[model samples]
Target: MPALEHVQPLEHRSGRTNVPGAHGFLGRLRRRRAQREHEASVICFANALRGMFRDACAGIGLCQYVSVAAGITVRTPRVAEVRLGPPTSFTVELMAGQEPADFTSKDRGPRLAHTLGAHGLRVEPVAGRWVRIHLLDADPLRDGFGLPSLAVATGAESVILGRTEDATTLGHAIADPAHLGVQGQNGSGKSAFCYGLLAQLAAAPDVLVTGSDITGLLLGRAWDGTAHRAHQVVGTQDIAAHAVLLEDLVAEMDRRLETIPPRRDTIRPSPATPIVLVVLEEFPGLLRAADALPKPKRGEGIPVGDRIRTAVLRLLSEGRKAAFRVLMLAQRFEATAVGGGYARDQFALRLSFRVPADSLEMLHGADARPLGQEHANAAPGVAYLSGLGRDCERIRVPYLGEYGEYVDRVQRFGRRAES
Candidate 1:
């Protein structure tokens, strides 16, 4: 990989790097200033944490007598460096057998943050008894870092979706045909995330993104490819037409599956045989449309509305091995919205953003409930990543700086399918 621009060059500062390359004396001065400030923040944060523990530890029944040195271990890097995403944080290693949930209990995050005299500090567990505390000084999710150019991501195997929050971390979703769901309320950056993910997928040579939306608010300009080459876009203009489109997409997916060599483990997308990612936007719109249909008659086939939903559920279940996947976006997610009591369970990955805590029910094994009105309602893109057998992670979608340009760029790369 190419060297990151944020990397401090050695030709300049002998002592340390301050931004990129301020030479010699000036670089050192800037470096020292940054280092001093970082060190001071670390000191203040540690002191405040220690004080908080003094009062809460004994009350919480923690084993104060368990180890030779029983206080929390503050593990923060001494190298004061600037990072591009979320603010860097420190971890507090508790005594053996003491897990993170012990101290990171509900409401304790705000309390500890207040004690340290900061807001927007994200506190969560990293491992057994190790609590990672992100002491954020600013809102990292407010803007975008430059995204991967179309040339860079096009034809590559996987797609970059977003970064994990406090999770100043980068994460990718493999096109090895993955099914992903995102649930969040308005102002939760839902549309922003779809664009970010779609832009990269659009760049990929082997991937084509087709989506359906009601308001067209999210997929508006982006899905407008040339008629001959445009990946289909399903509009809410006609509900019945939309339902039929869902069935058509499912049939298309089935054809892809049939072409896969039997017993093969996975289907890989390539330019010649591109894989399809069918995105369902503002999914509730589809649900409402589907739900409007009358129930099926006793001896007949599935109801028209029922078929649309069942098609989605089946697509998610059977499409993975066929190099086909679905990205479902919703303002609300729960059993009722998802077709059946067990249908929601089929989604391979689920992300929940700022909403009433109850919305977390959509994500299985979800522990961190949305902190409503907490931390000023968590940043717009801030959310939690959940899946079966995985620890939940807080994540944020990167901004797609220029929406129109991104759409145009995708159009340049994506063509209508022959399949």
Candidate 2:
């Protein structure tokens, strides 16, 4: 038998030898084949997504007869572009001339998501007649995320609430001084959200954090002996102390407003006069407790509840210029519960988490009624945020870990309070 001649490896122009499984001719061919397969698979997925979207629109009663304007384009693997068409006979009769608005409304978001059986969806109106449907492949907010370590030198002027559906951090601008309203049912992670927010605020040297908890659970252990703790954190049984806290806030607000220069519309916070964040947990219960207190026997006197309500309203209406921000947490934000519709409107930042229809509407207006039903079973810490110059969008509040870790973070980030 003739001995097999030894074959020298062929070297490609790029100096790579034709070794098996290396980036040579065979490897390039394999990569091209895989690329083609991936492209084909993506095309198939796009077609399927388009079909599902069309069927979803039909199921939601959005139809147009023989119109070129009605079509869905694949924007990405997870998003679809939809063009709005004139309403069909049924839609025209049902929505009259407002069918387009109804089609692109935020309220329709949940229904469209359900119809498509998507993980989560947000409908964003693109110029005239176009809307983008963002489909979440996996819920980014399903598992709570931890707070990012912020630079202490930067000084957190805004509190980082959580992450948005787009995986961007959602922050509430406290530096500009807008009152915030947070409402949710019990066990809705409302307290967790509060803790996260308070932790950030307490860490800011230019912020003075004071809070009252009707349950006495929120403000006690985590804040008691921390250097971040500023003013007294009133507890549940102290209805009179609640009144006193509000009154003191109002007095401070008045003092700041009086001292503001005529040329300036708002006060800038500093170590000398830090922004006052008055957090009232279970605010409605506090109001009720104040109302239950007996009237002064000396003469005609305002009930403690009325006094607290008046003080809160004054703060909401006039606090912005004075650098006093209120964060009111409650199960409901009805006009009566929050003093009135005017008071509710003053909260430029509103967050509703797993609340009832009435409560959602109270926070986001009547348009949010449909969303309330859609989010009736939203996960804890999931909430709708409104009044930041954008349509209300869903968000997930940051989880601060266990109680021990939360308290430790609070202490770690907290600055010593100025005398």
Q: What would the TM-scores of all predictions be?
A: 0.69, 0.75
Off by over 4 Å in 2: 1-52, 58-63, 67-107, 122-138, 149-156, 225-230, 298-300
Against the true structure, candidate 2 reaches a TM-score of 0.75
lDDT of 2 at 401: 68
Worst 10 residues of 2 by lDDT: 85-94
Model 1 clashing residue pairs (backbone): 154-203, 155-204, 155-205, 164-167, 165-395, 229-416
Point out where model 1 deviates above 4 Å.
Answer: 1-50, 59-94, 99-111, 120-148, 151-156, 217-221, 226-231, 293-302, 364-366, 370-376, 388-390, 402-405, 412-419
The global Cα lDDT (0 to 1) of model 1 is 0.62
